[model samples]
Target: MALLREREWYAISLRPQGQHRRLRDAVTRAGGHLLALSPLRIVALDGADARSRLRDALAASRCVFTSPNAVTCAARLQALTTSRTIAVGAGTAAALRRHGIANAIAPDRMDSEGVLDLAELQAVAGQRIGLVSGEGGRGLIERSLRERGADVVRANVYRRDVAKFSPTALKRFDALPAATALFVTSAEALDAALGQLDGERRAKLLAFPTVVASERLREACVRSGFGRIVVAASAQPTDLVQAATTLV
Candidate 1:
């Protein structure tokens, strides 16, 4: 993180495909200023003729976008050609709409549990579905869909690459007070940020009031020794900003 504004203490950002701009804008509109600083980037790897494979996968009976990055990377190769599309979160759904993919199935809750609860996935017998995601996920959705008698396949289109922070950003973060509110979007981001900190920076992270998107993340933060955790409804920028504004 970088650039600590006096009133923007709670504007901490977590990695979910680098979507802090929308959140910061929303917070500013709500009469609060939120600043986000991140050096981590998500990059797509070599997937052996990725464009062709992704094009083929998109033609499945149903397509599930595991994250915003999946939607973005797949869209780069080709427009979604599936009979139906599903997004794992509001951000991913918004990305889909930007690519002209409407009527995407997005659950009220933005997690694997909520995605499984959808009516479209319930009776998926004899269906062929495509899971558009990156590597290193729990595979719950894929397994559940298979259990429902759907032939499931995957197309991993991207991976997260943690970037090194400059000396200036590190100094800025170290200077932030413990009163600064931290926004922990994903468990991975929390882990990465904490791993980067030491001495006073680590101490401040532990003491900072944090806003998370899901109960799962809140539980993770609890284990990581974070106090004053606030869980938002979803990872949407609006939801995140609302939680930060109200809590911090």
Candidate 2:
């Protein structure tokens, strides 16, 4: 697909529900239109058992937040304390700072492997570690902590649900212009969005130039038959938008 510089640049966001505002605003600022496609909904876990788990995790020696959503959901349940906090990336670290946890640290790489390479986690034998995240993701962090002889407490503060798109929304996606770039951050969200489309629509979307958040996601896009892929510097909205706009 060729990008006509004279035409308006467009970007398709596959972020979760209520999470497209920042990206949308960023795209607008760059003089590009954003096709917001929410394929997942973030549901906070507020049951009694979940609360108890969160409390225990918060009281641990070291606490790690998997994502910004995890930080938000955890903050809603209880006051954030100044425990030895680690965030998966700069965005999650910013979320921690917003909740009054200023000393939170994040790795430059902004991924699970990066978190494991931290000096604080290197000597974690017999230490109690708390993992705050959504359900069924970031298993590598939890499993690696245990292998390092740390007592890991997993607090599942939220869950991702597959969101339903309206018929109108589906039609809009099907009619997107060829100059549109697909911005994908989460492989799961991308899969959920692709699952909603018919074979023809799916193939058409796969042919569009895609901007992925990481090399891992680039590989996922490759396996999904995406012809052109660009890896963003980080999962941040600015980086994703910058990478997407570069194609034009």
**Poorly placed runs, candidate 2 (over 4 Å):** 1-6
Worst 10 residues of 1 by lDDT: 1-10
lDDT of 1 by residue, 1-248 (tens): 22223554435665544567777776666655454546467887555667656766687888899887898888776767677999998888888998888889899999888999999899999988888887766388989998999988778787776766658767667666544567777677677777777776778778878888888889999999987989988887677766766565
What TM-score does candidate 2 reach?
0.95
Assess every candidate by TM-score: 0.87, 0.95
Give the poorly placed runs of model 1, Cα more than 4 Å off: 1-10, 16-18, 31-35
Worst 10 residues of 2 by lDDT: 1-10
Clashes of each: 0, 0
Local accuracy of candidate 2 as per-residue lDDT tens digits, 1-248? 23324558888899898899988887777778888889899999999988999899999999999999999999999998847999999999999999999999899988888899999999899999999999998999999999999999999999999999878778788888888899988989999989988899898889899999888889999988898899988988888878888875
Shift of residue 57 alpha carbon in model 2, Å: 0.9
